[model samples]
Target: MNISVIGCGYVGTTTALMFCELGYQVVAVEKDSKKLAMLQQGKLPFHEPGIDSLLIKHLHRGSLVFTGDIEEGIAHSKIIYITVGTPSLPDGSSDLSFIEEVSRQIGAAQNDYKAVVIKSTVPLGTVDKVREWIGKAQKRPLPVDLVVNPEFLREGSALYDTMHPDRIVIGSDNPEAAETVKQLFHSMSCPIIVTDCNTAQLIKYTANAFLATKISFINEIGRVCDAYGANIEEVASGVGLDHRIGPHFLRAGIGWGGSCFPKDIAALINMGNNNGINLLIVQSAQQVNQDQIGYFIDRLEGELHGLNNKTVSIYGISFKPETDDIRESPALKVIAEVQRRGGTVAAYDPMVFDKHPELKLPGVRVARNMEDAWKGSDCFFLITEWDQFSKIDWGQVMQEMRTPLVLDGRNVLDARKLRSLGFRYYGIGRKTGIIHE
Candidate 1:
């Protein structure tokens, strides 16, 4: 089968490559000329592990191609997946202008039956809007069916998630069209959930919202554990052993931040408010997540008495590891707080610092290397859970810092061992062990 994946963003590019890997010819469309040029050369515009290699491999095999022309892509395939970005508007609703424009273009170019599958995360009733837009643009009635097929790809491991998804969701009003969509995922070993468009949309939003709630729920519990000098990891492990509430999203730290959770939760809250219903739990989740950096900053201040001229180093910048994307990263919030308190902040990340120079906030120095960041710092905060950070020399870190205070924001450190090495250690939601001199 031939497939055209419109908008060569993270979701679009990965989906296009996955289609190519499935023995289908794929035409990847991108409006950005620079991104189109990069894709043509089998290079990714953004940082996603394992995708660029596949892109190059498929490009060599002639299974994948990149183009800037949407009409060409639409004409080449019967199944066109609109994987464009639906970025959040200021009002917390998704700005679907890109999707709308693509729909009109597809409508104008379609001469035969076309299945317009939506792989982008959109608000409820967006599939209807796409159908309406396409219907209005077409010269005559055409057999165009819209499918709501939201993506569940995590950033760092997007390709893996795409190739090895746990479940495949096919949403459409037309059973035949939905079944056709199901055929696209025939190679994957996962249960197919065939549902209406609205249910599928709700499933996407509800899934993210519930996951956000779990994060906030545990962080709130972490705060309680901290106050009582309890171990949150132990508490979370005990709770997760129930089998009913499996051990996922239970890791407590500086709270969740990424392209998906923050915006999705905000959009859901806005959706709730529009319908005259207040989503109190979701609202609290947002509040708790926002307050997390402040909580960490407060803990730092309490430990050091003041951050006024202290040299504080941060160990990670990306929201999570294996990707250079710093969008809505908690590390940024931490840097800003440290700067606000007049502390000099030095940051080092394996994948972020050089890839994204824009993260160089005022008063925050993006360090040249790990040693440069640690040198002469009073304290260090581990915000992102990168594997390199887990393997850092703690004894060397103690020697590098003047005060030897460590704040483990992601809880990816050995607290007792750090204290035994004469470094004061603080892990989120865990009891602070004493630093013996």
Candidate 2:
């Protein structure tokens, strides 16, 4: 199976490598020469665990090819996966310029029958847009079949998520096109959902929005726990054990962040509006998530009296760990508020410093170590739950800070133990300190 994956970012690069590892001839198509050069030289532009080695293995075996030539990529493959980013715009709608441009390119290059898979997360009926773009670009009807196979990979664990997905969704109005796309994942040993294009796209939006709703639900429940003397962790754990509810994104902290959940929830609400529906549930999810972030900031303000003239240390920058993407990170939002109130902040993440050397947070200093971040810091905000941050010696962090205050935004830390160590600890949806007499 000859395959071409366009827009070699996290999704494209990982998917192309997965296809290559499955012994399919894969070509990663990118327009950025710098990115293409990095791929050609066995270096990935983004940090995804285990993807670099897999790309290197395929490149060494000559099963994977890297190029910036659109014609070469189109001519070499029968299955073209458009894995480009459709980032959310200011109006809460996705920026479809990239998707439209790629569709036109595929149409221009289509001389024979091809399965053009839309792997990017887009609004429903977007496959029709691709079909229309193809027809318009080629002047006559183009020999291209549209497939909706929206990707479900998380940023930090994208490679593993792609390799061992829960199920593969292949949607097309034409049965033949859907089956052809299903065959590409025959070796993956996962259930394939074969449906029409519109359902598939809606499934992506619905799934993401539902997950976001759960997160917001639990975070709001956390607020109740704060008011009452209930422990959210124990309550959530017991609720998750019911098997029907299940525990996935229910760890309730500063709400959902990263690229997917926020955008999808907003898009779903807008979609509901266009269809003349209120979508009260999805709208509450969006509003509650905004409150979820506020919950964290509120905790910080209680600790340091409105954040003015306080020096804080923010531990993680990325929305999640093991990826360099900073989109919709809770840390960024909280830090910006801290800066607004005459606060001085220093931040550090081992991964962000490695890839983006020029990454700067305005009104904040980038620190090199836990000590550096805590040297004169008044408080600490634990944002992304990176493994390194989890393994940090809290005793030392307590010793180094100007004030021994720590906020667990991810809810991964043991607040009681920190309090036992003579440090003031705070957790979202929890009481101000440990429940001690």
Candidate 3:
């Protein structure tokens, strides 16, 4: 199938490239001239592992075309996937202006029976509104079918997620249109769930909310385990071994942050508020997530008498490993808070420094290497669990630091090893009575 993927953002770019790899002719549309120029030159505006090679190869193969002309894209393709951004508004509702505008364009541009699939994350009843917008824009009754197909791609592992999704959800009132959309992913071995538009929308929001809840639930339990002298790792392992609650998002850390969880949860809460319902559990989960950094800071302060004039080293900056995305990263919040308390901060990340040079953290220095980050620092905070961080020489770090302190924000380090190396180790929800206020 010839597919046109609109808006070459994170989701759009990945989907377009994956479709091209699957032997489909793809037209990737981007409105920005600069982005189009970059893509045309085999360059991506963002960093995604393995996608760069595929993008260059497909662009060379002539299977993929990047352009700014929406009409050309709409005219060339039988299936149009609107993968545009629906960012959160100030009031926590999804701003559907982009999708609405694109829908009108698709309606005006289509001359034949076309299946318009929504691959963007939108609110409930959005497809109905899209249909209305498209109907009014069209000159006459053109055969256009609206399908809701939300994406479940993670930032770091987006390429893998795109090819091997856990499930393919197709939500459309038109069964024929839904089946037609299913054939797009026929190469992949996965379960396909066909339902109405609302169910599909809720499924995306609910899935993220539940994962957020799991993180917060484990973190809250970690807090209790901290008060007592219990190991959160052992407790979480025991709970996860039950087979009922498999260990996926059970790793307790600073909190959940990315392009998806925070915005989706807020929009869902706003959704509940508009309908005269209060989602208490989801609300509490959000609240607990918000408290994670501060909670960790309190523990850190308890470890050191205070953070005044202390030089702290941060191990990672990206929210999670393998991507340079620092959107809503706990490390940024921690850096700001630590600086507010009169501490100097330095950070080292494999991807963030060089790729994301525009990343501005007030009163923080981007370090060159692990040694440079640890050199003369009072303590180290392991914010993101990059694989390289686990392999650092703790003995060398202890010798280089002004104070041999290690605060495991993600708890990915070996606490026992750090302690044996004569370094003061403090992990979130780990019971080590080494620090007393």
TM-scores of all predicted structures: 0.96, 0.97, 0.95
Q: What are the clash counts of all predictions, listed in order? A: 0, 0, 0
Runs with alpha carbons beyond 4 Å of true place in candidate 1: 357-360, 433-437
Best by TM-score: 2
Which ranges of candidate 2 are over 4 A from the true structure? 431-437
* lDDT, candidate 3, 1-437, per-residue tens: 79999999889999999899889999999998988899999998887888899999999999999989999999888899999988888898889999999999888877887889999999888988999998888878898899999899899889999999999899999999999999888898899999998898899999999999999999999888778868889999999998999878888888988778988998899999999999999999999999998998887777777989788898888888988888778888889888887788998998888877677777787898889998988899899999999899888888889998888988888888888888888886777664432
Which 10 consecutive residues of model 2 have the lowest summed lDDT? 428-437
Query: For residues 8-111, what per-residue lDDT tens digits would candidate 2 score against the true structure?
Result: 99889999988887779998899999889999999998888998889889999999999898878988988899998888887788888999998888888777
Q: Which has the better TM-score: candidate 2, or candidate 3?
A: 2
Error of 2 at 234 (Å): 0.5
lDDT of 1 at 55: 91
Model 3 lDDT, residue 57, Cα: 96
